[model samples]
Every structure is written in structure tokens, then in C-alpha cells.
Target: MTDVTSAPRELRKGANVAIRDLGGELGGLTVFLDSRGHDGETIDADVSVLLLDASGKVRSSADFVFYNQPIALNGAVHLRDKLVPEPDSDEAAAGWSSDVVTLELDDVPQEIERIVVAASLDASTARTFGDAAGVRLRLQRSSDAADLLVFDIDDATTESALVFGEFYRRDEDWKIRAVGRGYQAGLAALVTEHGVDVSEEADEPEGPEAPAVDETPDEAPAPPGDAEQAPAPPMPAEVDDDTGTSSPATPAKRSVSVRRPTRAPRLPVDWNASIPADDGNDWQAARLFPVAGIGSGEEQERRATSALLAVMSMVREFGAALTGRCGAPRGTITTYIEVPFGQDEEAYRPDGVIQVRRGTREWTALVEVKTSTGRLNVEQIEKYVEIARARGYDAVITISNELAGGDADHPVAVDRRKLRKVSLHHLSWDQIRAEAVLAARHRGVSDATQAKVLEEFIRYMSHARSGMGGLGDMGPSWVKLRDAVKSKTARASDKATGEISARFDELIQHLGHHMTGLLGVEVQSLAPREAPDHASRRQQLADSGLMFGRLKVPGAVDVLVVGADLRADKASAAITIGAPRGDTRPLTRVNWLLRQLPDEAKDSIRIEAHMAGPRAVSTAALLGKARQDPSCLVPEEQREIKAFTISLEVPLGNKRAAGTGTLIGSVKGATTTFYADVVQHLRPWVAKVGSPSRAE
Candidate 1:
């Protein structure tokens, strides 16, 4: 049974409480600032953190972590990527945007006595906190994602920045205090109060001001009118003894500057775009990591492991992207292959090992990898856990073809007792490929050679001979369960039914990762929070003869809901978005949505209008017919149209492999096609300025 915690304790302004009182001995906490702009306005509120000493001031400028300086105190505190509301969620409907600040409390330096969390508006904008609504903070335990407390800032006027709260050390424990303090001068004044040196550059009307400061603020300020600031002392570059490759040069410690980080210039060529199609006579380029000689599963695993580790070691951004997810500190990463270890009387050789060094502290994780259809061996993983624990390693990571759930659940089961000392994580080959693509294609690497190497790795992993094809098989029980459900003979407790349900969940999860890589945005699979467990999902499948999933694309007008219906032998993808506000005429609202979609979308898509009332009359029509007669979707009784749902249905495939006639391919194809044709083009209708707030 899920733990039913009471409502989060709301804290009034100036209220303080012990962190232990809310949740005892937390590994870490996450502060979420959910801010909403006034109707039709855009608010770009940025959240930041400050690590202060006993004197209530930062020891150095590095102690300030914000958008420009994201990491502080050796990764104990960092600013996460701006969070977009889940599509179709209440937050999305209400136009809420969230900024997250993560605190690895256990990793915070002992000298840090207080951690302050604050938010600031873009200085270039005239809007203030008064122009924002629903500005609140929710403190959550990062371990289980449970809300520990909530504070709503209801009192605000003309303030450009606000200090929402702070965590202070009390003896050996920590305590949180809600501080609803505001600053009228914006981010410059806000950070200046926290010991950051802000430059006095005249503000530009069109562009943001450059509030430059020396990296180490403790140094004497450079003379005014100096052309350039001093750079940090560079460390001697170290070459890896194993691969004979030069590692990124470490830099001397530096303080933070109150300035936006310079954005990288766009590359001359768009590496992400596809090259022009060529005739059969075109020359083929040689790859950095060739797959031509791969023969057996062992060779495949070895080559894949070596290739991944080598690329990670060479590419700084790619390495940080992967290791950061594993809770490693932001620093130098070194990887080794076939590391030998001993636990009790047995000797073990894991596929690879990863080590991260930040300052004098280091974290290590052992990696075990498998390719193709090979499943993880529980005993082998358990032995790795033992080795990691005995050797004081931080984690043991497993890579295989299997898919884990959206919640990072491991595919292989191991003894829970053995994992007390060493954490274990699993990464699917699909996920690894997605991350590689996201880094190389979407998020560019700084060094051109490193970028080329990452691109080559992506190509190598994508090749057919690499054996990294993801989600190709839906398991042997797929056909049996499909027939059973269609014939009305499937039971909730049947083994085949459960397996099919699990695979369907995996498919949805894979779709999220795949779309995220392709679109360069985070796409999350919305697992039913009420029925998140395996048993509940299996029961849901048996009862409805339908396996359903929803993908939440950030900033999308509506959630993309996909379903596979065994009874109907069809798969469908749909999106439901509210109709245009301030427009009462159903035809006008229908035309508003129609204008966003292309002419081709009318063929495969269906449009439905949801009307207001107790009964809530709903009328639907094919897009083609609706285009000719928009009134067909509007209720004759003249009820108010509340929303519209656009959907596309395709024949469900019956086979197991992800090919032309397979279930996996059909569902994936339907979703991507629908998104490209419909979802990507549709923007939520915002009311015009000076328009009536209510429907006519």
C-alpha cells in the first residue's frame, strides 16, 4: 500500500521549523519554485542558491549558484534545468513555470552554515513579482519525492527579486525558515547582498547588462575601463596513460561572477541536420569506432564498452551529462575497462569502471554491460554489489538491452540486504544511445574533435551490426495476450497478460526517451500515479483490454495520449486542449485550431468538441469533414465549447518484432507521426490584451 501522508504543513512568512521534524535524516532536498505570470504575460523567474559561512556572507563568489554559475560547493548545490509543466496538467493549463534547486545536504561542506534559496526576475523586463501569480515554494524530499512543506507568497508588490527561504545548520542538524523578503533592484542587487561584485555597466535598452566581476572577487577589482578581465590560472593538461588521449585541463579554484555565461556561437554547419541524399556511387566515410569486425556477443559487449568509456573520457559535456545523473560530483572523469576486484573468496572482473575526481574527493562506480538480447545475471550483479561495498565504491551500474520503468526501477532483482552499502543502477542501451544523441546532436560539445568523436560514437551505436537496436521485441507472450484479450478470455492474474502489460509500459518509457532525443526537450511518460505499481497496471490492462500511456511534452498545448486497444485491434494517439478563451462562437474556436494544423493533417486526424454543462455534450468529426462543415462538431443546443481533442487512429500490428507489421513499430510510428503533424504546430490559445476575460 502506498504511504498516505497528510497534507504538507504550510508555513507562514517568518516561520521556521526543524528539517528533522518534517523528515528525519534526509539524504537531500529539492526546492521547487513554481511561478506563474499574469494572463498573457511571460515571466522568466530564475532560482538561485547561496552557501554562506557563519558570518552570514559567502566565503567566496563560488558559493553563489545560479543560472550562470550552476554548480557550487563541489556539486552539493546546483541549479537544475528550468522545469516545464506536464502537458494538459493543471499547472500547464494555468501557465505555471517551475525552477528547481537541488541540495545534496550530505555533500555540503562543513564550513557552510546556511543555504539560502532565492528567485529573481529578468532585469530587462519591467514586470515585477506583482505581475506574477501563484508564486509558491514546495520543499520535497529528493529520495521519495514527498512534499515536506509548502509556502505560498501571497504578499508581493513591485519587487523584482525575492528570498523565499533558507536552510541553516542547527548544531548537527538543519532547519528551514520561510523568509519572504523582497528586493526592488532585481538580480544585481540580490546577488550583491550575498557578496557578489556586480559591475556598473550602463544598462542597454535591448540587451541585458553585463554585470561582470572577477572570478575571484577577493582579488583587487580590476581598474575601471580595463579591456579584459584576468583569466583563471590553467593547470597542466594530463594525458591518459591508457588511451594516450589528453584530458581536459583542470582549472584553479575561482569565485563566481554576477554575469550571464556567454552562449556558444552556432556552428558553421548544422551537425544535427541530415546530409543530402547521395547516389550509390558516393564515398562512405570511415568511422572512429568501426563495427565491421564485431562477430560474437562478447566482442560486441567489449567493443561497445570500450567505445562508450573512451568517448566519455574525451567528451567533457557528454561525460558530465551521464555521470551527473549517477550523483557523481562535477569534475574530472576517468574510465577503465575490465577492472578486477575480489570479494570474499571470489574474484570478479566488471566490464568497466568510472571514477570522478573533484578536489581531493573521489567517487567510483563499477560498470557491468551486456548487449543484444542478453539479460542481466542477478548473481553477477549481486557479486558486484558485494565487491563495490567491500572496496568502498559508491555505486555499481549495469547496462543491458532490458528496459526499466520510468521511475528508474532496475530490471534485474537482487538481494536488498546487499545493496545497503553500495547503490546499484541500470541503464538500457536505448537510454545510453539517447543520451549520446542528445549531447552530440542537441547539446553540442565544445571541442570540435570531441564533437566529431561523439558523432562517430552515435553512428557506431546506431549501426545494425552494433546490436544496440532498442525495444525491437515485445516478448513471446505478446501474441497470446493479444488474442486472449480480444477474445475476452484474458484474466488479471494470468502470467501472459502481466508480461504484456509490463512490455507495454516499457514501450511507452522508451518512446519518451526517443522523443526527448529527437526533439531536444524532455518528454516524460505520465505513469498513472494512482496505479503506478505493476499489479495495478496489469489489472488495468486486463479489465479494459487496452494498454494506455501518455507523453508529457514540455510546453506542448496538450498531452499526447497513446493507447493500444486489443478489443478493437487499433492503436490511437490523441491530444485534448482547451478551446480559445474569450471566444464563445464554436465555429470561431474550431477555426482557431484548424488554422494551426496543416492540410495533410485533415486526412488522418479526428476533432472533437467538448461542451460545457452537467452532461457536457461532446461532438466529434473527422478533420476532413470538420473542415467542410465546422458546425458538425459544435452542439446544436449552443452549449459553450470547453475544449477540443484531436486524435489519430491506426491499425494495431500483431507481431512481436519492431518491424512493419509489429506492435512496437505501429505505436511508435503513430505517436511520432501525430506529433509531427499535429502537436508540434498547435499552440495554446492565449487571450488578447484588452479582451474580455470571459467567453462572450
Candidate 2:
């Protein structure tokens, strides 16, 4: 509950958050952001605030406390920059799949000491893709300008090895850049890299050290106006020791007071054990999928990780560990775990299967994993039960994260990426997460590892997901979720989620191939938009005349414009341009048009953004408006009735400019505008006929 009296004035200033623009689509953007506290300090262990289109009310609501995380903007992060419809393997690529504004260099320049490159993908652009193509890498370089057939280093795959290439040479300063592309979306660096490697990190005259990481060269230091040059070398250092040995001597051996032996992390089951050799081509195959997402070596790894997490979430819901308390921590405690329905037997273990001195009831659960494209068939459920029964587990459970799906009828499809609707009995992702955590902990997982796993679980719960979202969701979060009903309700879901058991009569009925489906390996619909609600929302969209969408996650605008940093006249594809605002000089039309849009929309595209205003549409908006507006074109005989004008003149005025100095008073609208080559274009469509209007 919020304290109304303590709310800040800014919260009351206005209720509107001008949204990003969309061209020709009814965007249902749902974003999650954390509101800062009144004291300007962030409230952490944060929560997500949603910008939702709940039945078209356009509300900004907070669902629940969400784990604090770094900001995520799809285009801005995941697809930092995209190439013009290119692939990840197109050229040399480095850095994270996220992070916009990466510093990139065409070539490592000589005389340079450091380098930084920034790359980004517009938020608006990112939302357009449900998912698509992968990223690739090419380590490009050249001994001579024409000698640039730089070697290709694909995303890492055990088979596609380009083990070693001179990432850096002792003499030559290498130049590097990454080119990326998407499905129907433009290409750009998802984000920029300050430096590719240790050496490329530009050194501060009085700052940090530089190491050699990237092939790109450092920035060239300009020649001193009248000073002689001095030579320098990479820094070297030495350490001192207290032992009788020299200062650089190694540490003396010490007795092991606490021997916490390290253990290897649990690894994925080898596909070869269960399935035929795939050439380990899942990543490569993804590149050809209808909607293959980023294929950057790291991106593939990330997606794999995401899918793995989804699977893990379900596993926990199925009860991987058997934990039994003597009611007290004293009775012998024992836990058994495994995958209930996974390809691997280890994943079906259970919790609470201990031999207690006082109690005899067994706490046995069979944790399982299922990777499928669509809905479940009951027969599959029985198979899982059989496996559980064979293992003498108390309950049989199934789970999976990537549930690729399709239409409601044929919801079960085998999706390689598992992008679909999912179901495992009736357990929800959170329930699965909690149970999995308990199971893992009972099974002896370390506290630190448990925390990391919990973190991933929270992220899986945070998307405005579709298709398999419900399966992962267990059920909707909004339903009967009162604190009182939660535990009881969860109990009900837990039974459903944990219903698999070899002894249940339903198991036999579920086993026959003719039994249809119960769970595991059946796909649900991953197709994002199919509900009839779209019809209602579409009507609302018509009334608004503005495309609306939710971010589903935090997002930013990434409009591509002919103009960057806002120029008087620029081109962009995102905005729809109308006739110029007035008969006034073409340049003056901006002020007139700026008044036409709602203040919110105005801020969205940043009209007159140069001046300090609450919010300004970006330069991309202005450029897009300019390029798309019909008014910018010449009239064609009877073919087009619209009229417009083009002229060249020196306006008299003063207008403060952006990125540069101020311009004062005009023979123009504001004498405060700046210098322009003497030509212009003008067109007017809006008829503000009434009284004397400032723009008119």
C-alpha cells in the first residue's frame, strides 16, 4: 500500500508517460520498471511496475515485488545493434548480447592508445520481432587495405572450431566492427563496447591500465602542437613477500583448516546417449528456423541457458528432492532426487525420502523434465508414472521450460527452441521454483548455488509471455491470489503439479497410446496473439489511431531516422508526416506541427527537442516524420491534390540549437533558430480557422 500523503509532487505532476510510436501496428506494449522512492533512492529487492493495456484502461500497475535487475531494453540490450538485414556471422563480432552503445572501430588505428564504440537497437524496433534469426561472427582484419579476407570464427561450437587466430599481432593495429541483422528488422550493434579487449580500452592520461583483448587499435593521440615525442611500453609490476624468500617469492604452504573441496558443476545430459548424433547443429539449425533469434555465439549460449532454466523451473515443481524432518531437525533426514520425466534419470529424483526414527511416512517425489512443442497426451503421463514407480518414488512429476507450440488444436509441436505453451499437471512456475529450491537445498545444493538458481527463477516469472507462458505460469497470477487463499490454492496446484504416481489407477488409463495426453512432451500454443480479445483491442486501437503495445519488459525507443540528433528537416520511417504546419517558411512549420500533436505524442517523437522540455521525441522521430510525410513531395498534376512549397532564404531570428550554440530571433518563428543553407520546403494540411493563432 502507498502512503498518499508521502507521495512526491512529481508523481502528481502528470499521469501520462508518452509512449514510443509504432507504424501501422496495434502495439500492446507492457513494460516493467521500478519507481524510485520519494527520497530519490531506489527501492530495491525491486518490483516491476507495468504499463499495461488492461481492457484498454491504459493503466500503470505493479504486480508484485520482482528481483532487482539491470535495465533491459530488447533492441537496446539483446539486439544492441543490427546490421542491415545481415547475420551474426557476417563479420567480426564481440561483446555481450545485451548492452547498447558499444564502441566499435572500423580499423584499429595506429598512434591510438584506446578505443570505445557504442551500438544500439531502437526499442520500438525490437518489439516488432516476436523472435528471429541468429547472430554469427567473422574476425575480419587486413595486412593491407585490400588484403582483408579476415578469417571467420563462428559462434563457439565444439565442432566449428577456429581455435586460434592472431586476435592481435605485435605490430599491426587491427580494426574491428560487428554487423548484425534480424527478421524484417534493421541491423545494428545491440549495444556499444567501450573496448573489445584489454589493449583496446583507452587509457586515461591519469587513469586505468589497458590490456590487449580486441583486434581494434586504440584511439590515435594527436601530435603535440610543438612538442617532441617520448617512447613508452606496457607496464610491468613485481610483488613483495614476507617469507625469507625474495619479494616475488610464492606464498608458503599452509595447513588446510577447512577443507571445502571443490566439485564440478552438474552438466546437461549428453544428447548422444538418448538421441542420434545431431552434428551438434542445434545452433546452426536455429539459424534456419522460421523465427530464429540472435545466433551470436554468446546469444545461442544465452538462449540455451534460458531454455535450460525453463526446464529446471518445472523440475523443481515436480519435487526433485525428498525431505523428511523428524518434525525436528534431529530425526535422520534424507532426500532423494531425479528428473521425473526427463530424458535423463538423474533429473527425476525426489525429496523427503528419509528413514526417520519417529515417523515412517516417506517424502518421495519423482522430479521430471519434458521438452515438447505443444500440449500433452495422457499416455505420456502414464509413462512418467511407470518410471517413477519403477524407481519406487512416491510421486511422479514432469517439467520443461521450452514448450514450442502452435494453434489451439494442434498445440503440441516439437520445437527445438521450445517456444510454446506448456503444461505439467497444473503447477505454476513459482510453485515449481519454490519446490525446486527446497528440493535442491534438501539434496545438498550449496546456499550460493541456490541463490543463483533462485535469481534465474525470478526472471522466468517476469515476462508478459504468451503460448507456453501459461504452462510456465501454472495458472494466472491474478486469480484468487489473496494471501489467505494462496497456500491453500497452491496446495491444490501442488497436487496437480505433483500428481504423477505409479500406483494411481489413472496412470494405467493414461498409459495407453490411445489415452490422448496428460502431460510431458506435448506442445501448447507459443503463437503470441490468437485470443478473440484482439478484436476488442483492435477496435480500441482504431479509436486511438495510435498503435499501442507493451514492453513485456523494460524498453526504450530505437527509431531510425534520416536525421540523428534532431535536424530541422530529417527522415525516418516510424512517424507519419502530414502536410507542413503552415504557409510560413518551411522551417517554421515545425513549431506549427509541434502544437498539433498531443503533448505526450509530441514528447514521444521529440519535436523541438533541442530546447529543454519535459519530454522530446527523438531526432529519429523528426526524421521519420519528414521522410514519410506526403507534404514533403511535389504535387503531381491531378494525381495528387495536396499542395506544398520549397524555398531558400536566410531567416532573421534567434533560436537556441541542440548539440551546438543558440540562435536568436527570426525574420522567422523564433529568432532563436540557427544557420541553414538558404533553401526550404513547406506544406500545410490542418485547418485551424477560428481566431488569430500564434502558428497561423
TM-scores, in order shown? 0.70, 0.21
- lDDT on C-alpha atoms for all candidate structures: 0.75, 0.24
* Strongest candidate by lDDT: 1
lDDT of 1 by residue, 1-696 (tens): 012376777987777788889963443677898888766334678888878765466666677788766777544676877887656566777888889987878778787878889898755345789888778888876544578889899987878788888887776888888777787777667666666555554322222123332223121222222222212324446878999876433223344444443221122233235557787786766778888788999999999999989988899878877876776765678999998877787778999999987656688999999888888999999888888887898999998878874344798878889988788888887888888887777656668888889888888888878877677788888889888887778888999987788788789988888888777655778765433466776776787788889898765776789988877778889999888655458777777778778776747598889988788679988988888887788788677788999999999888888868788878988888788778876665544334534222
- RMSD of candidates 1 onward, in order: 11.7, 27.9
Cand. 2 Cα-lDDT: 0.24
Q: What's the true lDDT of residue 529 in model 2?
A: 43
lDDT of 1 at 296: 91
Candidate 2, residue 78: the lDDT equals 15
Candidate 1 weakest ten by summed lDDT: 217-226
Name the regions of candidate 2 deviating beyond 4 angstroms. Answer: 1-365, 370-376, 382-531, 534-551, 555-696
TM-score of 2: 0.21
* Candidate 2 residue lDDT tens string, 1-696: 011222221211001111111110111111111111122222121111111111211111111001111112211111111121112321213221311111112222222322112111222222222121222222111110111112222232211111111111122332222211111211111101111011222222211121211222222232222122212322222443655353222222221111011111111223114335778555643221122344444343334334433434333322222121101111233333332344344443322122222134333334333322233444555545555455554443334332222112222322322211121232323234334333333222335654455445434433323111222221222122222122333232222222211011111111111011111111111122443433433333223211112111011111111111111222111212333322344334444444333322222232321212254322223423643552432222212111222111222111222112211111111100110110001112323333122234
